[model samples]
Target: MLSAGPTPKVPLDSWEFVITTETGAEYRWSWSELMALPQETPRVDIHCVTRWSKLGTTWQGVSLDTLLDGIDTDAAYVLAHSYGGYTTNLPLDDLRGGRAWVAHTFEGGDLPAEHGGPARLLVPHLYFWKSAKWVRGLRLLSADQPGFWETAGYHDYGDPWREQRYQGD
Candidate 1:
């Protein structure tokens, strides 16, 4: 498990997830509301930019597709924001079509805070850093915006398989 900062202990009652479109429209889901949404247990493989790979890990959460349903946006990119102020950007398309989820459980148990409990974005197809642990919201943007790691010289699009770990990799 890895995080850019200390774990945030979010109270379930105050925890909420929001989706902000480029037009500033906001859609929100509280903890109870989010738990009521359809949930799926995805068994996936995750690779980190630091050169470690974990296969067939199981996670439970609502799919990004489900959360994005009915959201009206013409944006081409998305910036995932976490509770601790960590952010990561990705093409909007990369988050749709069953590619991602906001997971709250891992290995059949509630995710530990050390592991981004409450919830975290799961984008297994990309390097684990793109997962944005402790995720709280996604901001839809019309243009590309580099997030924390990207701005620190990490590859803007970190794909472990392609060895896209550093800016010039």
Candidate 2:
């Protein structure tokens, strides 16, 4: 688990976890509420832009589809925000159809803060940076808005199989 910032501290109190949409609707769920949702344990292969790959890593989290279910929107992208002020953007499609989750567990245990505990956006199909550790919320967008890494010239869409690691790669 690598990041550009220190691990953020999770609040001990009950706070709302929100997902905002481009249409101005917000769905806020408590941590317990999220845990109550159907959980999935996906064995995914994670590739890092830095050249490290972890295969078949187990993660437990609520599927993005479940969270977004019945929420009406025409958005095509998502900006995932983390507690420590980190953010990443991805095509909303990459997060649907069992492709992503807001995971709170790893390897059948609580996910450590350094590993995006409490909850983190997990889009295993992309480079690990797109996972956005310490994730807190998501903001839907109609356009392809760039987040931290993309603003820094990293590939807007990070596909490991295509070896899309940098601006010109």
Candidate 3:
């Protein structure tokens, strides 16, 4: 797990998202697009691979449970589209388990962009990389897939409680 350091603050009004693939493929997303997604409020603990664990982060944004609604995702895994085309993939079930969220606000305030502002996936159970920043969209896959650091041998689940950081798990 790597720490990008204390996240810089960016107002939600200034936050922007561009969903892209490893090959520079992209789809621009507007704040309104996110606002349109069904919203939910949840209590979460964020574990950064950098080792900063922020407990009880109250967030507001689209719930993975709702964002994926009606989408026929046959893939067994999911890849999160991110800035710089940096990406990470995880088990689809983990995403759909009703614990994931596209969080925009933290502690009732807008999340800073450095913290993956506008919106970022909050997978509290996994190491931070599994929780990609500047999240744009989700890519479904049929097998265990790796992304960015995962290709560099990072763990798949990244569960902090169990210390799933590298591939030896």
Worst 10 residues of 2 by lDDT: 9-18
Per-model TM-score, in order, reads 0.98, 0.96, 0.80
lDDT (C-alpha, whole model) for all candidates: 0.93, 0.88, 0.73
Ranking by TM-score: 1, 2, 3
lDDT of 1 by residue, 1-169 (tens): 7778888999999999999999999999999999999999999999988788999999999999999999999999999999989999999999999989999999999988888888999999999999998999999999989899999988877878889988898
lDDT (Cα, 0-100) at 37 in candidate 1:
98
lDDT of 1: 0.93
Candidate 1 residue-pair clash tally = 0
lDDT ranking from best to worst? 1, 2, 3
lDDT of 3 by residue, 56-168 (tens): 87888777777666555466777786654667988888977678888888788987776777678888788778877767677666777788888898887788988888889
Clashes of 2: 0
- Which parts of model 3 are misplaced by more than 4 Å? 1-29
